[model samples]
Target: MQTEKVIEHIVGWLKDYATNAGVNGFVIGISGGIDSAVTSTLCAKTGLDLLCIEMPIHQAASHVTRAQEHISFLKSNFSNVTDIRVDLTPVFEEFKTEVSLDGNQATVDMALANTRARLRMTTLYYYAGLKGLLVAGTGNKVEDFGVGFYTKYGDGGVDLSPIADLMKSEVYELGQFLNVPNSIMKAAPSDGLFGDSRSDEDQIGASYPELEWAMKVIEEGKTISDFEGRKREVLKIYNRYNNSNKHKMDPIPICEIPSDLK
Candidate 1:
């Protein structure tokens, strides 16, 4: 899909947006995933101040290693890139102590995982505010629009999304073109919120390619009755997520006051 032209377009767009906004540059959380690696690289290409932050809360070793590897690669290649590692494990533990944990194990665990993402988001914004930088989001098309797989007010919180229009496969293509660290490019896609090795596929129950196909067919006006077997199963999975996470995808509900009432 004119990969080179697409990359140029995104880079130009980012630079223009930041200049128009009067921000120094961007700050992004490096998660060692394909999306972040590609998005951060795009930011670096703009030749603006790029701060790569590593905020880990009970994160897996592999994820941490890949994140560090990618950051190192960026620093070596880009003169404008800088990085910092913020260990939030203690902060997370303290937060857990203050919150209610009365729910069932699964429910409580899910909440805590989302908390991890929110903490990282807060950290990024904190720096953004202090340094006059915009918080750059790393979400892609499938995760951001198709499945709504990210945490609202958490990873979904951002000043701008550079890759939200690109599909997961397209993000990978950008990663390849950007020369992201091999370790990150090869690792399984994950949210890293659960502090485990569970891949996004494990949580979503569908590979990105499968979800991409489903998203395309659905956009083309296809229905569940048109497919069978595994295709049907994948469609069901995609539909369930798309429906349930619509809140994340849509604008926040605002109650409009009647003119008489006002």
Candidate 2:
């Protein structure tokens, strides 16, 4: 598919979703990453009131400068861009101390990362309500349909996702197709959490290409006959998300009641 057509499709998807949701514009988290960068650009080009917010923790200094560059790109392209710098160190510290989770560094880092994600989500919803815009999800197909790499109430919460159906590789191609800044396209892809230690592939143990192939096979209804070995591996990751993120994927929870007189 031509990249320009993909961009147009993204715009149309957002337009349709917004119409259904009764919203006019989009609010995106600018994490100095490729996914958010492209989503912001698409929202801007469609003449939407695109608001980009930056919420970075103390651990993720790798993309701090990149965040500013992304804001610059958004400003030049979109007139309704808002750059908000939210430092979440104190909040994360308080959370750790309150929960007595200040012992484990990994847990602390995870908490901090989640704190940033939730804070950014809050900002998005705040302005989304004010401007009558929906919160645009930057997660692509690799993260969305395949593995569910996003956080539950944090990055996973969104009003709509325009590029959620596109694979990560497709997003890269679309970036070049739309002439997004090389800073964004060439920049490394990370969650900007835990001192740049957490990567999409690192946590999933599979690349986007591999995940896409498995997804296509499942989509075609041609199951384990071909790639049974690979299917097993993908199933492991798939099940991990299913087991760990119950609240994120499921319908409203129902409290289990004991069967007393059955």
lDDT, residue 24, candidate 2: 74
Model 2, 94-194: lDDT tens digits are 76676655578877667766776786677778877988878888999767756667776788889878788788889998778767778778765787656
RMSD of each: 0.7, 3.6
How well does each candidate superpose onto the true structure, as a TM-score?
Answer: 0.99, 0.82
The worst-scoring run of ten residues by lDDT in candidate 2 lies at 238-247
Q: What is the clash count of model 1?
A: 0
Q: Write the per-residue lDDT of candidate 1 for residues 63-146, one digit (tens) a residue.
A: 998999999899999999999999999999999899999979999999999999999999999999999999999999999999
Clashing pairs in 2: none
Looking at model 2, residue 227 earns an lDDT score of: 56
Whole-model lDDT per candidate: 0.95, 0.75
Summed backbone clashes in each candidate are 0, 0
